[model samples]
Target: MHDTTHHALQRQRRQVIWGLTLIAFGVAYLLQRDDGDAVVRLWQYWPWVLVAFGVNNMLPPTDGRRFVDGLSQVLFGAWFWITIEGWWGLNFGNSWPLLIIVGGLGMVLQPLAHRYFPRHQEERS
Candidate 1:
């Protein structure tokens, strides 16, 4: 079970890395995003960055490191959301298959990311 959990966690990390890479590839479109830009349109569905933030923060803290990492993730997500909405003028579209694929992937990884986080251990007396 533990091995399974660890494997799942690793898989989640890979998913996150790949998903973000796909999003990053949209940067050119993101930079020039308008109604006609497919890449930017694709990135428009990233509100789940906020959802990931919420999930990442709800983990047990082992020490200051965990807290800092959580804080950073939350901040990064918030910044990403705000910048995309405010600056990028984000909007959703009918890119059903791709949107579903990416969103579902990111969502699936959230729980596994939470699982891999350091856990608070009992104090040795």
Candidate 2:
């Protein structure tokens, strides 16, 4: 049944993400800096966890709700990444307002997006 295939696909995607994360960790361990500062450096990558979750939500059989949720996740992850990296001097203190604006924008735009690309009934199940 379609349900079975969907579950299988989800499982496979999860396994892939897990496998890649472990591999990245293993490589980081092998290439770690002297005095074990590598682990400290790796801690900065926590935002990637959100990115992974966002990517998972973007897999397939997209629905309006999931599409919006996935977009939010991706945007939040990117925002966090930028904040953590201090890119262009963006940080929580300075950029928090952008979050509210972007979130509101997404909410306002969702209905229009859904209208333009109506969800198919088969995709819902």
Candidate 3:
């Protein structure tokens, strides 16, 4: 019974995330329709989608793997945005190594997270 309730909650969370995502896209579409230049501006902000997804993944009930995945997404998204925007004189050519570093961080952190924050056996099942 508990498992069923948990599953239902998870499903509801996922539905909420997807619904919000759809609404966001719809609003963007409307903006684009109203102003053609909005499409160009929106294109540059594409990496924010990854950040949103990452945040969604990090929501409650997340485990080690999910948390690591979310963290990587957020880091990568922010890094990509920074590189594209050339903030602080950083660009893809010079800042690409950060991607590798982020990957390594995720790899290193996942096991440690799991070790320290093990999930309940019931949750696992």
Candidate 3 lDDT tens digits, 1-125: 35467567667876887788778878887868878788667777778888888887777666677778988999999998998899999998999899999999999999886775466333766
For 4-103, candidate 2 gives per-residue lDDT tens digits of: 6766777888788888888887788778856487778887887787788677866675545555767778888889889999999998899998789769
Error of 1 at 57 (Å): 5.2
What is the clash count for each candidate, in the order shown? 0, 0, 0
Model 3: lowest-lDDT 10 consecutive positions = 116-125
Sort order, TM-score high to low: 3, 2, 1
- How far residue 13's Cα lies from its native spot in candidate 3, in Å, is 3.1
User: Which of candidates 1 and 3 is the stronger one according to TM-score?
Assistant: 3
Q: Please, what is the whole-model Cα lDDT of each candidate in the order they appear? A: 0.51, 0.75, 0.80
Q: What TM-score, over all chains together, does every model reach?
A: 0.34, 0.76, 0.81
Off by over 4 Å in 1: 1-40, 50-54, 87-125
Best by TM-score: 3
Query: Candidate 3 — which residues are off by over 4 angstroms?
Result: 1-11, 120-125
lDDT of 1 by residue, 1-125 (tens): 25456446645754785677566656756666665666546666575565464444444332233444455555456555655566555333322244455455556655555455434322211
**Pairs in clash, predicted candidate 1:** none
The TM-score of predicted model 2 comes to 0.76
